[model samples]
Target: MWNHFDTNGTPRTNNNLEGYNLKLNIHLSIASADIFKLISKLKIEEVDASLKYFRSAKNEKPPTRNKLYVINDAILLNQKQG
Candidate 1:
């Protein structure tokens, strides 16, 4: 098991993720979803969590995009070269 805390010293748990799953199940109870679609939904939710900090009522601009782009570019370049 991984044990780590956020910058504010709050411990992380699967409770939040479980809640998301529960809600998704409830919402899609009658629907049939494919593996790719489910994975895409989870990935979109992950991106939302990462962007929450940058999304504030007072903040006009978020600085996370450039950083994420740089990291993604490096990974892509590595994959291409290797």
Candidate 2:
């Protein structure tokens, strides 16, 4: 696990990927994971991080109907249906 050394000459671990490695280690510690389980967990965390960032940056609010927009959409939908 230790090949390269950090600037201090201490053998380094996965510090190259600081944030990600920390998260993966936490996941591994919490559960017994095979390679496939590890990959799946990483993928889910990646998506969760991406979505979290997206929502935070965009200030996304909870889904709610705009009454006027909903009514207009319903009218259009009814016309197509009938």
Candidate 3:
């Protein structure tokens, strides 16, 4: 009856991957990653940046935006300024 509540702990990361620095390091240089991995990684990074941009926007105009097109252009401005 309690089976549903029993813990089913699982490793969140691949331990066997520890010895693969050279191999995994390749993932760091997106060019080394295959199309699927590259797209996923880039999409994740973009989503993270977009979330931060909008969260920091906090319903107020980001100063970098300057004028119209602010919403669409803020990310470019932030990138250049950074």
In model 3, the Cα lDDT at residue 69 comes to: 46
Candidate 2's residue-wise lDDT over 10-39, tens digit each? 323454479777878887876566888788
Candidate 3 lDDT tens digits, 1-82: 1232322333224644674555446666654567787678678768877987887879755446336444425544455556
C-alpha-based local distance difference test score of model 2: 0.66
Model 3 TM-score is 0.34
Worst 10 residues of 2 by lDDT: 1-10
**Residue-pair clashes per candidate, as listed?**
0, 0, 0
Q: lDDT winner between 1 and 2, please give it.
A: 2
The TM-score, computed over Cα atoms with residue i paired to residue i, of candidate 1 is 0.35
Q: How close is each model in CA RMSD to the real structure?
A: 14.4, 21.8, 18.9
List per-prediction Cα lDDT, in the order shown. Answer: 0.61, 0.66, 0.56
Please give each candidate's TM-score: 0.35, 0.35, 0.34
Would you list the clashing residue pairs of candidate 2? none
Candidate 1 local lDDT, 30-51, one digit each (tens): 5787777678778877888767
